[model samples]
Target: MMNFSLPMIFSFFMVLCGLWSFVKYHKHLLNSLLSLEFMMLGVFWLMGLQLTSVGMEIYFSLFFLTLAACEGALGLSLLIYVVRSHGNDYFSSFNLLSC
Candidate 1:
């Protein structure tokens, strides 16, 4: 069994909080996006700690960070488009068929 360290514990807590926030505020796109960003941060921190603990290279974490950046850019662009079209940022207002 792998031993948990302080960074790992902190990361886990952050991820749990983020997930809870996401579930509790799913109807609010901004809130959900913020929660998702927190979750991604937790993942990055945990992965970095794991890599350092095992004496492995950090390339994978770097790649994941890049991918996360791209995802954020795309997500925000989509959100902007939705807000512009509907004049509101609620997830319930989105309808693919209507677009």
Candidate 2:
């Protein structure tokens, strides 16, 4: 029988929390961004685990994390723009031609 370590357990838990966050709050754009952050954290944890398990560096994972951060920043910026123009962050309020 293979034994699971603490890191593996923690990684799994992080993934579960991330999935839960995404599922529990799907309607709000801010919440969706927060949930995506949580999911990226899970990816970070999994990358760490893979690094330790395989004795290899995770340069690509770090790059992926950076990309995720950029994506989140852009998303939030768009959300802010929408809110400033429409007075609300609801998904249904976006109309490109009306601007």
Best candidate (score: TM-score): 1
TM-score of each: 0.93, 0.79
lDDT of each: 0.91, 0.81
Model 2: what TM-score?
A: 0.79
Q: Output the worst ten-in-a-row residue range by lDDT, candidate 1.
A: 73-82
Residue-level lDDT of model 1, residues 1-99, one tens digit each, is: 989988799999999999999999999777888899889999999999999999999999999999888888887887888788998889888888998
Model 1's number of clashes is: 0
| Residue pair clashes in candidate 1 | none
lDDT: worst 10-residue window of model 2: 87-96
Q: Report the Cα lDDT for residue 99, model 2.
A: 84
lDDT of 2 by residue, 2-68 (tens): 5688887887788788789878877667887787888788878778777768888788788888998
Model 2, runs deviating above 4 Å? 1-3, 92-99
- For every model shown, the clashing-pair count is 0, 0
